[model samples]
Target: MKAAVLFEAKQPLSIEEVTIAKPAAHEVLIRTVAVGVCRSDLHFVDGAYPHAMPTIPGHEAAGVVEAVGEEVRCVKVGDHVVTCLSAYCGQCEYCVTGRMSLCIDAAVRRPKGAPPRLMLGDVPVAQMLNLSAYAELMLVHEHACVAIDRDMPLDRAALLGCAVTTGAGAVFNTTDVTPGETVCVVGCGGIGLAAVNAAKIAGAGRIIALDPVPEKRAMAEKLGATHSFDSAAETVADEVVALTRGGVHHAIEAVGRPQSAATAVKVLRRGGTATILGMMPLGEKVGLSAMDLLAGKRLQGGLMGSNRFPVDIPRLVDFYLRGLLDLDTIIADRLPLDRINEAFDELRRGETTRSVVTFG
Candidate 1:
C-alpha cells in the first residue's frame, strides 16, 4: 500500500510503498476512500506538534471495511464507516460516564513488543491519531470508526470524521446553542463553516461568522450566518458586541490561534461560554481577564467537539441526507492522494474551505 510518510518535521511527506498488517483483536482494516486535508495535520507537518518520525498523518477520513478482527462486532467486512481520532476504551471512566472522546486508555492499541500495524520495509511506521487514513489502507481499533449509511458519499462522509464532528458537535454537544441564542464562530475554514451551518440548524437567532477571508465569510452567509465580519479588522470584537447590542450567547474559536481565541472570548455576553475547538500551540495559555471572571464568562476546550462518535456520526450523516447540513459547500477541492501536498499548500495560503484527498 502507498502512503504519504513524514520522515521529518517541517518537511514534505513522501509517497512510499508501506505495508499494512492485518487487523489485530478488536481492530478493523479499511480501504481508504476519501480523507480531508485538515489544518491539524499541517500543524504536525510544520513541527508545531511533535510526533514520532516516519508517521502517517491524515485522520479525517471515511472508507469501506475490508476486514475485521475478533471482537469487532460494531462493524462488518463490507460496512461503510467514518474514522475518528477519539478512539475510546469501553471500560474507561470517561466512556462509562458518556465522555468517550476523553478516553485515553491504551487498551485500543497493541501492547508493547507486539508487531506494529504498519511497516515500511523492516521499519515500523507510527500511526497518527489511531487512524492513519493517508495510506491506501488503515488498521484501527473498531472503536475508532463507526459504520454509516452506504448512500452517503465517501468524500463528504470524510469530513464528518473530524471537521464536521468537531464543528457540529461543539454546537450540539459542547455549547448546546439553544434557539434564539446568538453565536459567533471564529474562522471560516472547514471547522468554522460547519459551526456556522450547525448554528443555523440549532436555530441560533443570530449566527455571526468571522474570518479574514472575504470568500469564506460569503460562504458562511450562504450556509446560515446572519452576519459576517473580517476577523482581521482591528475592532472586530467591538463590532460584534455593538451589532448584538451586548455580546453573543456563545462564541466558538475555530482558528487555533491565540488572537482568534481572544476574539471569541471578547465577543461573549455575560454568562456566555467560549468553546475552543481548534488545537492551539502546545503550552500556550488562554485565560480570561479579571473582569471576565466577574461577569461569569467561561472559557473551555471542546476536544473533538465533546463527541460520542457512535451516536453522533450516524445522525450527522442523516442531517446531510436531509439537506439540512451542507457538506458540499464546505468542500473546496478534491485531489488524488499523490497530490496531497498541494492541498496542504492551499491550506497554508489561508484560502479555500477544504481539500479532500481521494483514493482511486
Candidate 2:
C-alpha cells in the first residue's frame, strides 16, 4: 500500500510503499476511497502541534470495509463507512456517560507487543488519529468508524468525517442555537462555512460569518450566512455586535488561532457560549476578562463537535442525501493520493474550500 509518510515536521510528506497489517479482534480493514485534506492535518505538517514522526497524517475519510476482525460486529465486508479520530473504548467512563468523543483509553489501540497496524519496511509507522486514510488502506478500531448509506458519494462523505461533523456538531450538540437566536462563526474555511450552514438549519435568526477571504465570505453566504464580514477590513467582533444590535447567542471559533478564538469570545451575547472547534497549539492560552465571566459569557473547547458518531453520522448522511446538507459546495476539487502535497499547499494558501484525495 502506498501512503504519504511524514518523516519530520515542517517537511513534505514522502509518498512511499507502506505495509498495512490485517485487522485485530476489534479492528476493521478498509479500502480507502476518499479522504479530505483538513486543516487539522496541516497543523501537524507545519509543526504547530507536536506529533510522532514517520506517521501517516490524513484523517477525514470514507471508505469501503474490505474485511473485519473476528470480534467486529458494527460493520461487515462491503459496508460504506466514515472514519473518525475519536476512537472510543466502549467501557470507558466517558463513553458510558455518553461523551464518547472524550474517551482517551489506550485500550482501543493494539497492545505494545502486537504487530503495528502500518509499517514502512521493518519500521512501524505511527497511524495519525487512529485512521491513517492517506494510504491506499486503513486499519482502525471498529469504534472509530460508522457505516453510512452506500448511495452517499465517498468524496462528500469524507467531509462528514471531520469538517461537517465538527462544525455542524458544534451547533447541534455543543451549543444550543435555538430558533431566532443569533450566531456568529469566526473564520470562513471549510469548518466555518459548515457552521454557517448548520446555524441556518438550526434556525438561527441571524448568521454572521467572519473571514479575511472574500471568496470564503461569499461561499458562506451561499451556504446560508445572513451577514458576512472581512476580518481584515475592520474589527470583526465589533462589527458582529453592531449588526446583531448586541451580540450573538453563540459564537464558533473555527480557525485554530489565538486571535480567532479571542474574537469568538468577543462576539458573544450575555449568557452566550463560545465553542472553540479548532485544535490550538499545546500550552497556548486564551485569556478572558473577569468582567466577561461576571456577565455569564462562557468559553470552552469542543472535540469532534461533541459527536456520538454512530447516531450522528448516519443522520448527517441522510441530510446530505435529502439535499439539506450542502456537501457539493464544500468539496472544491478531488485529486489522487499522490498529489497530497499539492493539496496541502492549496490549503495553506486558502485557495480552496476542501481538496479530497482519492485512492483510484
Q: Give the distance in Å from residue 207's predicted Cα in candidate 1 to where it truly belongs.
A: 0.2
lDDT of 1 by residue, 137-211 (tens): 999999999999999999999999999999999999999999999999999999999999999999999999999
Predicted structure 1, TM vs. truth:
0.99
What value does the lDDT take at residue 118 in candidate 2? 91
lDDT of each: 0.95, 0.91
* TM-score of decoy 2: 0.98
Best by TM-score: 1
Clash pairs of candidate 1? none
Tens digits of per-residue lDDT, candidate 2, 282-309, equal 8889966997899899998889999999
Question: What are the clashing pairs of model 2?
Answer: none
RMSD of 2: 1.0
